[model samples]
Target: MIGTPRIQSLPQGIEVGIKALAARCREGEKRIAAALRELEAFGYLQRVRDRLPSGRVITRTIFCNQPTALLRPRRPAPARPQASAPNPASEHTGPSEQPAPEAPAPLPVPPPPPPLPQAPPSVPLPPSLPLVPPPTAPKLPPGPIPRPDELTPELDRAATALLSDLHRRAPQFTLTETDVRQLVPGVAAWLERAAHPDAIRHALTDDPPVPLKRPALLLKHRLTELLPPAPPDTQELAALTHRPRITVTPFQTCEDCDRAFRSPTPGHCRDCREHRAEDLRTAA
Candidate 1:
């Protein structure tokens, strides 16, 4: 080593080491400050408060540790006296002084009086209701017992007259018998035959359709057809003309006699007709 220069005042080894340590610490502080500034520039830290070079906080800080001075409280201004008119008993003399007054003694209060009781109400009497009268029964008029008329027949008159000489006799009863017979058996037979095609065509061709009845009625009906049609002025005559009439054009073979009748009337030939006439005369 080069000759150590004699120093006017020499630092001890501990002192030099302390100086070196302090320089390192100062460099560390500079690095920490630079990193903090970079974070702040990158928006990592929000500058809430400004700091002094000595590291003491000037304003209140949110995240970092730094000493802040306690703010001294401001003294309040002295109160001025009001301009209101003062009472002689309440006038003040000094800042610390107060007005004095005569003391009062407490007074005793008496207890309240008790409530009065009320009397009970009396029961009321009810008036009696009027009684309703019963309804009267209706009166009936007497009827007359007159004698019977001579023309009007009495139910028990014959028995009374006949039983004049007898006592406790019952009257005889009479009942009339009614006779009912079916003379025309083929009333709706033609109506059923009207459904046939030949009958339908014939009805279509004819001025009016024929009626439904027996051969005797048909013979009479054919004779009626020979007469002229009625005039329109007389509705009764027109109705008679318009009235349906049937006619039987009998075939050669007769159903009743089994003999062929050459003429139109089949069952009652000229001989049969004479026989029928004589039978009718005998019956008359």
Candidate 2:
């Protein structure tokens, strides 16, 4: 099994149990089991039994890179030799044959030395000086705080603009208010992380490596994948005091086509004006 190319090509992290291999190869469990048994008999597969600290036994299957011809059974250890006892006849004869032993001579004692004179007492040392405290660091001046309106509505506007742009560019996706609400948090997170709106738009609109069945799901995935850098610190935000604002243009209905358009003249749209000019030229 280890020598098989198909098994070799499998990822290390992938599960390679009998059932998993069977599913991957589109084979029956019985067939896989039989194949495993054959491999075991051929010494290509080995089972190792482990005793866990919890007293539970577990068996693991190992794939041998090189198969063995035969497996030798473990041999038992040799028995240890016991100590021999003393003979009773030798103990009985020892007292009658041996003579009494003589006592050892006493050792000579040495004389003690005379005591020496005592030394004078030592003088006391002076106490240490007290330690001086360290100087405190200078405080920094407070930075300019942002206006309440400016701080509160940035995330909201960014989210709204992102969703609106997505709808305008991909009308076929048919994004609803519910979807917009659900996707707002993600957009706001990008905005909070200091990502530009154009960057977010590009990330969402870029062609993915694989075809997408669900636009919402793909968008969510891209949002996570293309996460922007973290939000700038207070000092950086203070440096960026001004932000660009969007201006809304009012629309009026064209008299000829009844279509709404932004025009200073307010009488007709570009299309209606073009058509009127063409009509006059044809008549002339």
Candidate 3:
């Protein structure tokens, strides 16, 4: 059995049994069992289950000089795998120790979260402003006034004279030079409308409002609101075309009867006035 080609050529993982061993040794089962018991007692053999590369488990009979050496777990073969038959004359090296695993990388540390935004500071409010009184209004709406350039110097002088006489006409309408200057424009505009000087004075002084505050503003409102309409176009054209002549004659003492009368020339009475030739014939 030791030098047989069949036993040598057989695969590594054959089934384990005492019958096959007894057959090979030409002994009965009882004698083989006795031999196996003696081998176990002497620590030269051990039977254990082993796994094959094909994932099959089978009982294997192991022979060793020292059974304690076989107790250490053996890693899988590196150079030659157990799946195929090993070469008969090949020299096998010892199993190498396993390499240690490298330490795992340290866990990364996250940066601190961004600082929370700060709130804005509060501000105080300013004090409220005081209320003001509104200016007083007149009884009428003063329309647009004539420009200073539009008023003639003579008309301005006449307006000033007429406004100056208001105090004499009505005792309450006393005014200052500044007030008169400011009102001259409105009065001159009235004169432009052909309003007589006496008529303007009468209209202003006739019914003066009691407790008059600003005389200039009052007069301005009256002049604008109560302005007269322009003269008729025919009369204006006739006056423009043929200027009318007015002769002023003053009354005087008559040399004959010492009576007063109207005459174109000074120093004359009613009978002293020259009569036309038609008047003499009518008298005859």
Candidate 4:
């Protein structure tokens, strides 16, 4: 009989289904189908349906550490017979029962071997090698320095994306013309390495102004640095604005948990709960 303790030690559903599965395992079609159903119900169990030597699909249970009581003991194999040589006297004597021949004489022993010579002592070498001059390193010419006009497009796009992510984070910080001009020098220098120089210039132009992204990014970075991570629900944000009916600004999401705080405490999103749980764990 299969041991209850061995099966009970396994994951829950599999343990319960063991008896039902044994008979089905012998039946190829039923075995795989039953395993599949079990797997679907309990995702933790990793079972595979494989084709047997009989060309039929069967459930192949893997990684089971069944106790001795749960499994049948394998039968021991029979020992092999040893081969014997024929008797020499019997082979030679047919009609005349002849005796065995005498054994040959032993060889003579030689005189004692000579002793081996001992090895000579090792001599130390004198350390007086002449010093050779070291090889000179080649001098490399300095590369030409980049000018402001050398800003590339790829650099601009990278800066823009970074700024966009930052702006999304901090809504309180407002960007201004002065801010753009202040960031222009460093951004122009960075643009030299960017692949798309024109894109960066377009972003900075006064029309819509490209440099706004930099200041916006800086504001976001500062805001996150100043504020604590957000609470789970938008209720906190709604209370801050004193507008329960109003929709929350996308940037107002909690730094800790990205839950929109427009509504009351209980209305927080599912992710907010996990975020809060993690926060509690860390705090503890």
lDDT, candidate 4, equals 0.44
Better candidate number, 2 or 3, judged by lDDT: 3
Q: Identify the runs in model 4 with alpha carbons over 4 angstroms from their true place.
A: 1-149, 188-284
Candidate with the greatest lDDT versus the true structure: 3
Q: Write the per-residue lDDT of candidate 1 for residues 120-147, one digit (tens) a residue.
A: 7877879665465346644444222112
Clash number for each model = 0, 0, 0, 25
Report the lDDT of model 1 for residue 282.
Answer: 100
C-alpha RMSD values across all candidates = 44.6, 32.6, 43.7, 31.0
TM-score of 1: 0.12
What digit string (tens of lDDT, one per residue) describes model 3 on residues 136-235? 5333444775434378989989999999989987878889999898888878877877888989987776676788877777777777677777667887
Quickly count the clashes in candidate 3.
Answer: 0
lDDT for model 3 = 0.66
Q: Looking at model 4, report the run of 10 residues with the lowest lDDT sum.
A: 63-72
Mark the regions of model 1 whose C-alpha exceeds 4 Å error after superposition: 1-27, 50-57, 60-284
lDDT against the true structure, per candidate, is 0.35, 0.64, 0.66, 0.44
lDDT of 4 by residue, 14-132 (tens): 52344455653454545545654554344323334544435577563432232222133323333334445667766653585544543332222222334457789879889875466
Candidate number of the best TM-score: 3
